[model samples]
Target: MFADGAMVLGAAVLCGSASVVLGVLGVRLIDRRISGGGRAGMSASLDAPIQPMVFLFRDGTLVDATAPARALLDRIGPPDDDWGRLMRWIGPRIPVAREQMQQLARLGRLDLRGGEGQGAATLRLLAEDMGEGVARITLCDPQAEHAGIVVDSMSLQAMEEELGLLRTALDQTPMLIWRQDAQDRITWANAAYLRRAENRHHGALGWPLPRLLESPRPVPGAGTATRRAALEEHGQVSWYDVHSHRTGDQTMMFALPADAAVRAERSMRDFLQTLTKTFADLPIGLAIFDQRRNLQLFNPALIDLTRLPAGFLTARPTLFDFLDQLRELRMVPEPKDYRSWRQHMANLESAAATGHHVETWSLPSGQTYRVTGRPHPDGAVAFLFENITKEMTLTRKFRADLLLGTTVLDGLEDALLVFDSHGQIILHNEAYRAIWGEGEETLCATISAWEARIGAGPALAALRDALGRAFEDRPLSGAMAGPGDRLLGWTLTPLSGDRAMLRFRAVAGQPVPGRAELFEAVGDY
Candidate 1:
């Protein structure tokens, strides 16, 4: 019951020979029934083939398989057209199988060894050409040629179903998966991985499929690590997030698509750079804080306006800390007390959170800032600082000039009235109101009263004509009767900017000053 060299048999015979015998007998009985007992002599003659596991192919099709070979095919679970199926299984182990199988006719015979498989053993294949496009492939385990073992049909069938289920799941997943040995050699790959390898390697794809990712070779027993890698095809770059998990003496790798995530991250980085360039040239100081009240962004103007160092600003201080820094520099208005200052700051933050808020800060250094707080997206806030010192100074100077002019005009004793080019009265002194008796503040009544006093003479008529025209820049003088019958000298003068001024004085008695030597200082401006 034993072969001559049985002592050199492998564990495959000790573990699986009985199952192979049963599988061969079952296939032979079915064949005999189908061939109507006519092929009994042929079946008897070839019941046992060479190599314990052999396949006979004529015209690239399987015509016969040995007993051990039929058992292996049963385990692999392929249909009648199993040449392609056998090639796929052998590819990882014997990478040259597909390439060299085509050259077997010219070469006559070939032998190859595959990578290590389960139970820490290598598989061997012997291929030979029988001429005329006919060939035979013999797969043998050197350590198990003389041993035999048994397995029930129920157990085998259950194993086949479970194997099919697992294969389906692995092939159906869109992710690329592969296993590598301790030496970083690819041992096996799934359908997705093969598809990618095919696209890259094209017709040359076979055993141990080509590596698709430039991913880092994971160190042995380093646990799991993830990284991103790039793959280029058809001039378009694709990205993947590769995960490598190390187990035992091998590493299992998975790669998922990351093209979208990479693009989004690139876009966000470009947007921030653009915003930084835009903010660099702004004149207004800008500081932005996030929802947690930490300073997230600021412009160069903020550094210049606040006089803060770039290093400190880049450190990303909290809002209160930033305010404290500003306070140390006397950049904010001096507070009433420490506690009240803090309370005011809290109120400012609350107000800014709601919408728009504004505060004017007058610093001890005499710089005035118009500070505006505006609400931003995602519960963030932005502060803008604009120096309004020059504006404030101009406004104060204008108010002072108006006050000095009004004081001088009201102190005048001579009556004065000024009219715009449209004949509308714009300015009148207290003396003019006193002379006209507080009626309508109009010029027509004053002219009529002057005519009544002066008897409508030609000189008075000329002065009236000059006043009415309101365009001539030269002065005209005339006399009107005073209350005590003294001569009241009146002047009508056209001023700059299309305005007219009428003045009245005592011509003989009121010459007290040097520039008063000039005609008729009514309001004394």
Candidate 2:
């Protein structure tokens, strides 16, 4: 009785092993019945063989398992639990079902997920009573009743092919793709990343991103950010536009190389530095405004000429604001009316755009400015301010000296004419016009010396000859017959810088005073 009770208890705990033995015995019984007990002729069914998978346990240790079951369990991992270890190997898609199945298995009941080995399967556990203290337990994988339903295998094959193609495309792309875990460790990187790293020994995988970069970490978020990354292996630096997306515990980072953009910006910065240095040394005050009329650049001369504060200029004021500041400081021309100020500013801009504006600002402080506007590329405008105060002063003094000289020459009795090196009668005094009867028509226009000589008659041929000799570094004086029996005296004097002065006197009896006598007369005057 004790042995029989032990056998019953063992059978109850080992039901998974009993199911397998019972299934085979039931098949045999069906075959025997079909044969009607005549020779027990058995015929095999023309169906696919069922791949059996089961594990049997006696007490708490593994006793038996089907070959397929043992192979699958071993492929997953080493067994650590007595509950067949299949529960841990099953996928987590149906976690609740797996847990329930585990619990039921421990209770010695038949329970299974209705799927296995890439198809629908059924697991069964059975216990069979045996003689003595032994019981048979079977864990069986039967063809599921719902296994009649067919699935298209082509869809799975297509999916795998598409996945392979996607991986190929990613590997061939020039840009790099990287995957990171929650701890910011780089889990996977693409072919481009590998090419940049150039060596597998760097061990990018499982390392923090900062280990491969100059910084320990980049700013991370959903938005795209740009940063410069230096490959420590090659010491080559490149810019990258990095975008990140997070899915669960893993983050995907996409990086595109911006080396060309970085190089272009560097070149532009260097060019601007060169331009700034060149403009700094110029004497002309230069102020440049952009298309928006904002003052974008100004030179040192601009600050000195405008007398505006450098701090104010650095604030990037608009053109109107700059003008207003200049007006406030009385550096620019003051407007006649307050209401016309805006119109004046508009006109100034219009003139600048057309490159036709030119104005002189006579400041109250006696400083004079000659301001000019010019159009530049990209709808920009440049203003040049030049301090012409000393220049203007010297020019005015020269003009006054010229007027005084004209007055002294007009006071002389002789007719004076000055000829330039080109033989053009450039300057003729009023006395010459009076003596030669030359009207404004002749005096106001340019007259050649040869033309003047022809108009004066054959008697003045000697005067022309004397003038030619003076040009050859020989001063000449001669007498010639005038229009109505009067004698004309002429003297040609060579002056410096390829210039000559010719004087004529219509003498009543004798020639005009000599150089000494003329100087004495001019001193008395």
Best of the candidates, TM-score: 2
For 1-525, candidate 1 gives per-residue lDDT tens digits of 376457447655765888888899999999879796657767765554344678998986888998878777765534745676677677666767888887888889999877565324567889988888778898866565544446898999999899889999999898889987766767678878877887876653545556788656555557888889998977889899999987777778999989999999999989878887899899889999999989888989999899988899899998899999999999999999989989998988989989999999999999999889999989999999888899999989999998888778766867678887776777876665545434244567666766665467776677667676667656777776553354567787888888888787767764323333222333342
Best by lDDT: 1
Q: Model 1: runs farther than 4 Å from truth?
A: 1-192, 200-203, 206-228, 233-236, 241-261, 408-468, 471-525
Clashing pairs in 2: 15-126, 15-127, 16-138, 16-139, 17-137, 17-138, 18-137, 18-138
Would you estimate the TM-scores of all the predictions?
0.57, 0.62
Q: Compose the digit string of candidate 2's lDDT tens values, residues 54-95.
A: 565554356777887677676543466544345433422122
Superposition error at 330 for model 2 (Å) = 1.1
Model-by-model lDDT, in order? 0.77, 0.66
- Over all chains combined, what TM-score does candidate 2 have? 0.62
- Candidate 1 collision pairs: 9-143, 10-143, 10-144, 17-149, 18-149, 91-207
